[model samples]
Target: MTAIAPALVPLLVTLPLLGAAIALIAGRHRRVQITVSVATLTVVCAIAATLLTVVDLGDQAIAVSVGGWPIPFGIVLYVDRLAALLVMVSSVVLLAVLLFSVGQGAVDNDDDTPVSIFHPSYLILAAGIFNAFIAGDLFNLYVGFEILLVASYVLITLGSTESRIRTGVVYIVVSLVSSILFLSAIAVIYGALGTVNIVQISQRMGDLDQDTQLVMHLLLLLAFAIKAAVFPLSFWLPDSYPTAPAPVTAVFAGLLTKVGVYAIIRTETELFLFNDVNVLLMVAAMATMIVGVLGAVAQAELKRILSFTLVSHIGYMLFGLAIATPAAIGATIYYMVHHIVVQTTLFLAVGLVERRAGSTSILRVKGLMKAAPLIAVLYFIPAVNLGGLPPFSGFIGKFALFDAAAEEGDPLMIALIVAGVVTSLLTLYALMRAWNLSFWREEDDSAETEARISYLGDAPAASVSTERRVIPRIMTSATVGMVGLTVALTVFAGPLYDICARIGGALLEPVTIGQLEQEHEQSTGGDDKGEER
Candidate 1:
């Protein structure tokens, strides 16, 4: 059982790859596509849970070398508690999206159902995430990123609608460019250390002058900042994500940028463990949050507003990262788990709303209370939760973050706390404003929109539901999935906090980081001695 944890990491990546292949072969077959997708994700979830169990039993991170090569030679895969937890959270949301997609009848005829392409692409993305999470080396991380980007390009451009394409061009260009930057940084890292293994790199970095280390750190950060859609570098996100298909957007909202943040957190702990690097992270966090919410307030569309909020909330995580305390980092990790599920849920719900109401633009769509009561409740719960209202996961996550900041003396950190509160308030206002237009107010129905809508041989779900029930059953289920996650994060704060604490100890102490490097050296030294003998 203990030995299995390391092997399980590769299985997590492989299952998604297998599913993507099946999805590709069965593109026109909705039943096959959905079945393969759901089953693959389900298995991934199980594997992640098991990995978590392994971590609970011991502090040792599961490690395996591909092609029987040790670290710094062949590719290496490893999973600590941090990676396992993220995988678990991701699997849950992926399952929910799969369920919601099935419920929506998004796939019908083999020809009409693009789910074939979606399945393979989605799987590829998941596989990339698994690889990145477990990757023990820099080059391996790059492989993971390329796979994710390739898949994301397809998903973002799925259905190939005019708007999606237009936005996708910007998205594709920005993403590709970011990838190139990341590649360049990796090359530099390789050149600098003569090895691209993360543990080895950390050891090499410690030998370098502070300025050299700073340069490397900054370069790596620039790459992640682009992925994170942090301020100034984030203009491309709000433009592209909202126009993509619902599931694509939902996955993007929940997974893509967060990957960047994960990388930042990992690098910060491994490399820059000494100084208050949280200051830099803090500045970025504050900028990302304030700008994100402001953009949300200005947006007149539903999906777009959510997109801004998605970017904005990234700040809170950064805030915690910036503080660099165990409590702060733990809160950051917890917040990420909460955010991924809730955001995905909200995106799916909004997509359903857009289809039912004939538009995502708030100016064009209206009256959720009158339109779909279940959906109204769905939007309301996440919308308010996103605002970080008490009892919601968002609130719990933020509360942990701010509490950590309170322990610090930096005025900048203090300001981050205040900004976090303000952002939450404004986030609420923007969500509520959109809510007012889309679900509460009445609006004129357009014939063009109606013609594009397929009622599945019946009237729209929105046309029938009364205020008592709110949202449709399918949409309601999707909403429930998201709200349930939010509640779980809120309620499970104790254990979750503990997991985060352990991860922080791992990161801050970097004993694991040290152990991996020393072990690599000892292995190499033994080989040298054997050859000498």
Candidate 2:
């Protein structure tokens, strides 16, 4: 089983790329494209699940050197508890969103997302995400980002309407700037250390002067901060995300920024464990939380509100990361997983609300609780979960984070805790307000609704009405499946959090190049022995 596990590492990436090629070729046949994409991600999910189980039960990281090359000279794919869990969770999210998109396309006559182009690009994006999670070298990680950038530009601009096109351009330019910074950092690292292999860099990072180390560190952080949508660097996200198709926005909200967070995790924990940036990061976390939620509060449109909250919640993860303790890191991982699931589910629910109502503007839409109770329930579950209400995964994750921060006993940590709590309350208020306006208020109570809207002064320009569309059962099913998964996060929190705690402990203890090389030899030698037998 161990010997075979090494072989499966590459398939996590290769299968999706192969499926993408097939999906592209079969684009003319919509059914074929759908089958290929779904089957591919389903299989990827199974593989990732197997890997997560293997890595967890074995209690060790798995490393594969591609094409039989030696470690430090080859592209290595590494999966420990963190990477495997993320890949598994990501595959599940990708598959669910794919189904939701399929349903949307079917009902919309493939106008919003043309299956021929969408399927291929979506699979490619999946490949990029999986690759980023498992990447063992800086260069390889950069490649993953580039692949995501290319595929996302295509996905985000589907239908090429003026708004999408404009947003896509902004997304592309921001992404390219970050990529350039990342590439430049890689070059500098390679120049200083003679290699881009992550393990080797960690082993050698201490040899550099403190100033040089700080320079490299800041460059990497700046680049990743932009990707992760950390404050001041997060300006592009709220504007960029809401313009895409529902599936595109959902997946982007759920997975893309998390990839950036993942990179920051690797950078801080693996490469520069002793850095002094925690204070800087904590300040940014506070600002991101306060600023993002404030933006959400001001937005009149549901999508835009979700978009800003998306940015706000990112700060929570950053807060945990800035705390830089094992418990905090564990909480961060749990929160990240929680956010990915809950955020995507919320977006999917909003998509349903949009279909049932004519607009996502709470001012224009009304009485969904009476009109479409299922959509109301669907949106409510994840919305409150995101708002950090108790008994849900959001609350559990936030409590764990706050508990960890309190243990630190630092004033800044306390301030961040206060910011996080305030952010949570505001998130609840904003979402529930939307719910009240869109779902609770009677449609005929226009006078009352308008009276309420008058308090906003000028925020109702985006509240224009449009024709409502029919809601598809598959779309609802997809959302229900995601909501169930979100609930499972709380149901299974004990074991899942045990895993995350173990990952946090393991991540702090960086594996060296020597350890990785020896493991590679042992696995390959065992495979040879099996062949001989």
Candidate 3:
């Protein structure tokens, strides 16, 4: 079990930032931009994968001090087993989305898309996501969120259509509100503890009065909850997400909200340590599961349905986090990975469906199973996996989570568990409905049916018609690659769950702040002696 070099830490962020700059400079040359973006992310993925292996082999958390300052004063990039695994998965998803976007751009011939701005902004977005995963301090995490928000705002509104602009406004406004709350919480925490370093704060948070701690806890959780789109705060997601281009929607659905979930995980396990808010989180989890899936059931469009289901699945993650047990947290980790891949694959496949059928509305699209069997397979695999069908990662993850919850044997836990099962069933129902309408059902050719009137008594067209559009091979291939990763998750569920369980256990173990401080001092002392000599 060898340790990864700390030198690789800053590169995880700096490389993407550098790639963004190069991509911006090469904006006029789309091929150049694509080359640079792909190359940069490829390197990042390699580093992240290596780091994950190292951490999973029992290496301790790898910390890098930016520009050689000591711990409390300097920015740190920390990669433990959990952070490393997230970075690896995120990079893989980013790369796949980039390829999908590039392919879509090439096929569309750039009329409706802003190829230049998209490349650089996408890279910057990836940088922010990676930064968030490895940040070792509260302030740094906030920075990560701001970086992502800026890039996402650009990416979400890339097409500059009227609907996209409107939804982008909603997305940005919600993000700004969340950011403001997060910054305020950071300021108050710094004022109280005098340090925003996570370990330092973890060491001193117990000293705060219970009332103050509760205030801080609620403040942080409130902000993350909004970001995670849990239940009551989730109305914005379904509306904002479904309007974006498919690649944009896919990445946003897969990664952005999970960043919020990651923050909540850090807060509960690292910062607050399972405080009295478990009941609140549990209630929110149950409501999120039920309400989100119900919304999915009512939607007539594929992306909207997926968007609502996205909100629903966040409940499953919250369910595990609320439990706060090692097994529960491990299950949460597994589910997070599964959701990121399956959701992205589903959305990407939906993009293909839209390309083939001219629209994503279930009412408009029909007979895709007969028209595009490969795309149907691509969509079905992820759809069922997301619905927690057996012999898939989704099923494996949900089973682990339910087992953990039932072990608690509390009334609330039992209730949430039941909600979870119902949500899973409803998710499958909603998705299968879309599948049947958009793929299985045949359009009618009868003259009477063709001349059907509008509900408002307006005359209809002689017959409803659909023209299947060209789906680029590269676009389909990229989607297939993502779906393959989802299948791989199921195939390798055993080892992945083991890794997640170890990470969860490690997260619950307390850190010795004094020992960390001593190590920082010793390292700095060594640097000073070397300079003196």
- Candidate topping lDDT: 2
Q: Put down candidate 2 lDDT per residue, 339-442, tens digits, no spaces.
A: 99999999999999888897888878888999999899899999999999989999999999999999989999999999999999999999999999899988
RMSD of 1: 6.1
Q: Candidate 1 on 361-420: residue-level lDDT in tens?
A: 666566768867877877788888888998887888888889889988689888888999
Best by TM-score: 2
> Model 1: how far is 130 from its true place, Å?
1.1
lDDT head-to-head 2 vs 3, winner: 2
Q: Considering only N, C-alpha and C atoms within 3 Å, which residue pairs clash in candidate 2?
A: none
Q: Which of candidates 1 and 2 reaches a greater TM-score?
A: 2
True-vs-predicted CA distance for residue 23, candidate 1, Å: 2.4
Query: Lowest-scoring 10 consecutive residues by lDDT in candidate 3?
Result: 453-462
lDDT of 2: 0.91
Candidate 2 regions exceeding 4 Å error are: 526-533
Q: Ten residues in a row with the worst lDDT in model 1?
A: 459-468
lDDT per residue as tens, model 3, 1-533:
24235668789999999999998998899999999999999999999988787656644667667877666678877788989999999999999988888888897776445788988899899999999999989999999999999999998887788988998999999999999999999999999999998888888998998899999999999999999999899989998987787889999999999999999999999888935589999999999999999888777678888999999999999999998899999999999999999999999999899888877877677778888889889999999999999999999999999999999999999999889999999999989978977788666634463243122122121122334557777888899999999999999999999999998898887565654554333434445333323
